[model samples]
Target: MSKRKEKTSHGFLNNMNFMFREQWNFEKTAFLFALVFILFDLTVSFIVIWLPKVVLDSINQSISPAAFITTIGTITIGLMFLKYWSHYSEQGVLKSAVNILNMHFYIKKDWKILDMDYSLSSSAQGKIKIERGHNATSRNIYVNMASFYPNSAYLLKAIIGFISFSAIILVLNPIIILILIISYLASAYVSFLVQRMEHSFKDVRAEIDSKLYYLLEEINHHAFAKDIRAYNMKSWINDTTHLFMDEKYRLENHIQTKHFMQGLFDVFLFMIRNGGGYVFLIWQMLTSDMTIGDFIFYFGAITGFSEWLKQIVMRFKNLTNANFSVDDYRYLMDTKDASKRTKGATLPAYDQPAELVLENVCFSYEESDRVFINQLNLKVYAGEKLAIVGANGAGKTTLIKLICGLLHPVSGRILLNGTDSKEFNRDDYYSLIAAVFQNVSLLPMSIAENITFCKESEFDTERLLDVIQKAELSENINELKDGYHTNLLPSITGNGVNLSGGEIQKLMLARALYKDAPLLILDEPTAALDPIAEDLMYRRYDKLTKNKTSLFISHRLSSTRFCDRIIFLEDGQICETGSHDELMALGGKYKEVFDIQSHYYKENSGVKLR
Candidate 1:
């Protein structure tokens, strides 16, 4: 597992690098834009510093009022317009760059998600889908810290700006330069501490997110929500949720308080920097070494550097937060999926025909002792209909899933025509099997598309018509406004209509028929239909399955009468196997179940079931 983790981590980086490489050219463009923006911003600072000196010198001299007024006015208007254009260009180009980055993140991340395993897919949805989305919208807050920027360039620009400010300060006095340097170092240290606190808060948020997901999944899937409410579990839900929320709230507050304290330190440091520089300048002026122009330049330069330092500190905080997101993204990307074999034994591909053989099959999920199937043995001949009858928890659906290659048995071999099923490529093996379960999911598409499973080109029009009639869906289709072409979901805009449960079941049957695979497994296939439709289904199933091997499961005894043979499963073990009449004559579990069902119908409806 450790080795697997390492391998996945390496692969994840390679995948991320490949995705980022596509934007390398755009990154260069952004770099160029950054340089332009920085130069323009620095130029404005220089103007602020030097222009005050020019004006102060003019004021000190005995100059013509008209000339001085005209010169200063012309200079002010031109500088203001230049500043406006440069700032606009900087913002426009940077915004475009950010948009491109967003596009790259979304498109590539979506691709990676689809290719990932089920666990990682769920993880990505939780983290990248939510947190990453929030972060993307907050790009202005974190872009500097996100590792998206060229950090070396940022450092170089800051150094250059600092040098320019220091040079001006040195001209006044070197003491001001020392003050600015001290304040910057102090702010950097405090910002680092605040970032560590923020990271701890983010970890707490992740735990909250996990608990919320569990609550949602349970509410949506299991009978938990209904049972809970029925048993008055509102207090339990409230307590659990509040406990989760309170911890998250407390952590956030702690982090926020730390951040505010860090900001306070920044405020105090700036005051000391500016206050000390001004006090030294006053002393120098009183001693007659400093002029008014020098004082103005020093004040302007110091103010600009202080603002720049604040921005740098904020950017560092942003970087720290983004790093946490990066860590999460990488962890999700590094998770291993379901194991697959490359050079293992191969399953026999059907040519003339195929047979299924389960030899001492045993299976379980993870490390659970509650095994679903244990030492189960069975055989299915080519083109034969086998009915598997069992009570709810007897692993009937599990058996069919194993046969369809959806799962692998832990302790036995499943063979497709004498070859171990695991030897075949899982996807290729599944392509030859068709299944319909009690629980059916329909795609948001037209009725015809759902029937054909969107494989229009491959659908046989004649066979499609025949299957629709067999499944008793012809009447339902004919009643639709557009017949089979009518959309099955109205919420999808111009292509939609609602479908009844029976209509949906008929469509599911049509899909299985359209596939026309060698093996068909139907698990409680008619459970959702009315008695009349179910009776019609059983009557036609024998004719429909003429040349295919099928495994049918049903709680309704009437549905199994058409099958060639019946296998009665009880508590993960096969208790009986024979034809319908033979099993009844034997008077086993099958006969007992059939008699109970038959007696009920006879008494309730005044008509014999068989």
Candidate 2:
């Protein structure tokens, strides 16, 4: 096998062993069921083969009627029990196993996402790989892990059946048995090759599908609805979809055509194997002194043995495909995010107010020339309220991400209470932050549930209601029939409570306050609201934060005056810093931008901003 193929096979077997280790005791229980079913079914099958011969022989010998009836009844009872129980056990085992494996994969994936290096999730290539790992579940031809156990069991059972039946056929004619086995095996080999060829394009297909998924999301997005209609994007959407669909269609069509031809060859091989058996059997019967019952039994056994061979081959093909999927899944589980360290590190520094300091922090994208942060040195004392203001490309948002531990500086260290941010346990470090972003995403859930983001067992209803009131959302929520329990969705079929932009921002604020993290970061949370409301929110920010160390980012410089300290970011560096009044007195970049924004609002009834 090629290196890649070898890895796929190795991964497949490795994961099977992993499954055993994960739930070894339970797997043995399932395998026990399989063993009983296979053994019983095998015995019943041979009895079936011998039944017709036994009946004919008894009739010719004039056997006792009572004995014959007893024999037939016994065989019939065995067959009935084996047939029903075999199906029941196999399906029951399959369903139970699949559910367990699905849950395991989910837990594993969630853990990886929660603890992975921030860089992996934040970068484009990393995102693609993460998606591929996600697609590894339920994306295989046989639904990834779904086919593995059943296919392996089928192969094992077929092998046992083949050995038992082939012994009978060999005595009749070994040459015929050998030729038929070879032909069937060859056909299966070809089929396996074709299947591997089909799976090769899966990654490319996943990439195209990801892009298409994004476009579909864009079209259906609630915020994009008005712009889509007004901008006449419907046709563009259809045309774009067709462009991608055409490529997918062409690729799939080509693969299906090749598979179709291979399938026909397999059919042709089956015909020759069966027909040749018929021709050989007739000649043997006429030439040899084989008894009528023996002749009939041998011929039937030969055909049945060939069927076992075909089944084993089919199982092999399924096994090969299933193994490739296991490879995909394992690859994802092992993929690392290199931004965090101390894999099992714990945080003993939590619960105290966090002092954040940046020591010559610099950040930039690998592909971009723009340095988002350049040798930036700053201190956010515990219980401080700081605002960061900048132009569109001045990297206010990037700075927030870096400080929040969602993005690490390319160079320099960030000190979290004297310890480097990367050295601290990432999850533990994350527990200190509560961020409300400009584009806050709400789940399709109840209002209170969205606020708390907690399960029922951990819910604090009184605390939730208080946060809602503080965020100025209590009145709006109370207006609804369901109040705090109102569901947010596109799928309530018009029954859902559709929150406005300001309401959404308020909801985001409610969540942040509910979290009560020491370091609260608001990335322009009020940028979408009217000027008066924005000003009101800025005034209330201190109260909401409880004077905890907070970093707020906004392009609207007027709304930032209330913060204790304001930093003006220009060209990826802090060009000016001090209180709003102090910066204005300096007559630097901060003063220039603030005046420009202040003049525009003054000329427009203080309702609009520049």
Candidate 3:
């Protein structure tokens, strides 16, 4: 137990020091001012206690001297101005520190989330970790930072005043100080218990708040507003919110009731403490040669001592709570990015077909026993258009992710041009591939900026126009009010135009063409379009791919006929591989699913099967 306590103490100090350096380096002067002003604030309380003693003694002695009067006046004005300046500077310093730390931590967290390994962000457990990591930032960590500056200083002042006042109480009567110390300690322990209990439930509260925020978002958000109203889910939404809050408040009331009981006991201890001290001090005055000023000084000192002790105790409690946040923040930062572990000495090439090879590669989502890809050994030669056609959940997209280095294999190596894909710098490897996912999304930005995903100054206008023409988005672009500069949605600019489903898909295709990476991945790129529109896009696939190595994933097998080769997947394995004619003659799973799709299309088209 002692070893564990010592380790926790060491960790607290270490994490506090790291936070000071990580955030406060730039605002050292503000932090220093905050510390100094806090000491001044503490000093004024002692001065207040001293002034009354001196003034009362002088009047009792019948000293009517101007010097004494003038001295009192001077001290009064001096202390007033001192307090005012101290307060002004403290606010100034604190504002600077708060603003800087918020920005500094924001930048750090934003980058950390952006740079975190996709494996961590892609899983349910990993997302919870990310939220916890985010909690370690912003306001919870803000309190920890405050503890380092103002709170620590407040604690220091409290300690100094507590000790000084205790000495004065001892001078009056040693037994009195001892009794008060015991009482103060007992009260402090009760307070600590109350605070610790509250702190212990903070994680539970945080989880509730996180879920509530998401639920509220889903209710109020544009994405669900139409559907929710159409479904008439208002009552269900209200019920869910009410149940969540009811549980939260029930837990809160339970803690509050416990604190109330503790408060009663604390009050009893304080009444005994205060009553005992008054009796002791009054008895001393009656029997001993203690002056009137001594009586006043000692009484004020005793009261001040108790106040300082409580402040000190509260400061300790604050530090203990803040340390938990620091621990989480530190843990998150210490977790290394998975891709950073294997950055070999190479940058993947640009403007060349990326030759990808998978040797017994496999992968699965975390917390799942079922494999998504199993022993997936395959080779994709440069400049080959390999169409991956499979049933739903056939690992088509997962295979593309592994080949493009968006995901790493679990058991075997994936190499590109004979060099291990994981060995290359992640940024450079990702730069080699351009992918359009099944879910097409556009940022609330200018049409040109969406295509470029870069600043207008950096964009190549000629190449962008060429890609837009190739993507068949030029006709739609011409219809917009601001032309290339028009915003895609009203989420940003009020005059933004919303595109039709097919137009949005075309815009995404334009983006992929604009990237023109060596490797292209199209996962159900034409899912939003009609059959005729899909065939039109399919006819242009060869032109769009040109010399680049491309992996096209689609459920519509008719599109695979244009590819150089095709692979059919089932139950986490590649079941067949061949061209359309070869698969048809072989009479495999590929041919059977293909014929089913073809027969349906032929019936709809009123055309004979070729």
Candidate 4:
């Protein structure tokens, strides 16, 4: 757990300025409406406070009934207009503008996550920042950017009202104003303590919330449904959920207790201010020459003054809380993009195959100190078919990611066509290679869109058919009711069809082929296929890699026999390099693993060793 940095007033202002500038027109319109509403509200409050005094004065002076009625009626109409204007501006325009502004921030946060450095964005710390940023903009309604405009407007109104009411009370006696200020200051202190307590619980609440969310997702996810039912895990899950729920309840109760204590203290302070002030006023009215109208006016001023003072403290506290949320949002937005997506050297054309070289490349994940790919050096010639054969933890996937520019090396360079790959823009460099990893991910869209990885309008019909045939997915796709136009993932659409594991892998292969890049990488491409289907796919490998540089990774040693060269990885280094016959002749680690696999196959099917 990292300690959060203390945010300075200057940092808060900077973040606020950034947020306002991002949606200047919308924010400006909201602020204008807020200002109009606040002004009208204050006007109405003051008129209501003053009206009683005027009515009493009219009665004592014995004014004409018609004149009194006309005056009161005019004032009443003015108050109604002000109140209506205030309500209309606040509910109709300001609220809608704020809602739109909230949506803008949500979109901006998601876009930042999409555009940031892939290495960082996929890491543990990156996920924490993403969650915190999301919560800042959406979770807490009172302390989010959307509430900033109205809260600030109310703060301004409080300050103005405090000044106006204070002056009116001061005319009666400065001592009463001083006492009211002292009582409110004490109340403000309690509020500060409450705010601090709430802030302290934030991280804890976030952790519990994350756990609860994971559990709920597990309960609802289709993948977990079978296991949960087969394993009779319902009672266990219910108990776990209740444990966390009880913890959350205790936390809420503790927080509410603190709030209740604060409320009690406020009531005490309210009594001292109002009760003491009223006694002083009554004494002055009885002993001094204060009129009935004066008594009514001064009493209203004292109560209004105290209310305004309380608002001043409350609004300031709310603003302080909102500032913390802005800090979280700003922290994520300011993270440096290590991939340099915006500005970098242009990549060379991919008209022919690309040559790749790794020089003393070293890599490790942030959470681990042990190097996963240590000081590795290797090269793949242009237009060569190379095979990477290794065990499960041999760093094959890590090396492929480094070569594809998904992960950068710690202390070396990957040269693309003799130019350092880092010199090219990350997005531009991606255009040179088409890769299919062990995991096959399919989006909820038409099969054609998934293969093309583009919108329907941008798909190349002729090229799509070519790749589908080459990848051997034409038959499977044609069996579907809508053919290539059929949607995937029934969870997203009623007509969507879920493809089998092998069919999904074939679809992924078609997607990679449609890219038509200079370099192609297949990582266990036939993992889900039957043995015969896998052999058939491997036979087509030559046709697939015919004019491009290709790298094939697999644990099945026999499947890689046709490659021009094979490399065996052990302990994060290239332990052996040779063709299939050459490695077999060596009778080293490669031959040993191959013979074991051959023996198993011979026992199972009585097949001759290759």
TM-score of each candidate structure, all chains considered together:
0.75, 0.88, 0.88, 0.90
True-vs-predicted CA distance for residue 520, candidate 1, Å: 3.0
Q: 397 in model 3: Cα distance from truth in Å?
A: 2.8
Q: After superposition, how far is residue 176 of candidate 1 from its true place, in Å?
A: 5.2
Q: Clash pairs of candidate 1?
A: 145-319, 345-423
lDDT of each: 0.69, 0.79, 0.77, 0.82
lDDT of 3 by residue, 376-405 (tens): 888999999999988999888888777777
In the range 135-220, model 2's lDDT, one tens digit per residue, is 66663325565567777777888999999998888787888887788888789889888988877876777777788888889888
RMSD of each: 5.6, 3.5, 3.8, 3.4
Residue runs of model 3 more than 4 Å from their true location after superposition? 1-10, 65-69, 140-148, 184-210, 239-265, 341-343, 595-600, 603-610
Q: Indicate the residue-level lDDT of 558 in model 2.
A: 77
TM-score of 2: 0.88
Clashes of each: 2, 0, 0, 0
On residues 34-118, what C-alpha lDDT tens digit does candidate 4 reach at each position? 7788899889879978999999999999999999999999999999999999898777444644565557777788999987877
True-structure lDDT of candidate 1: 0.69
Q: Once superposed on the true structure, which residue ranges of model 4 sit more than 4 Å away at CA?
A: 1-3, 6-10, 25-27, 92-97, 193-197, 200-208, 232-261, 479-481, 538-542, 599-610
The residue pairs that clash in candidate 2, if any, are none
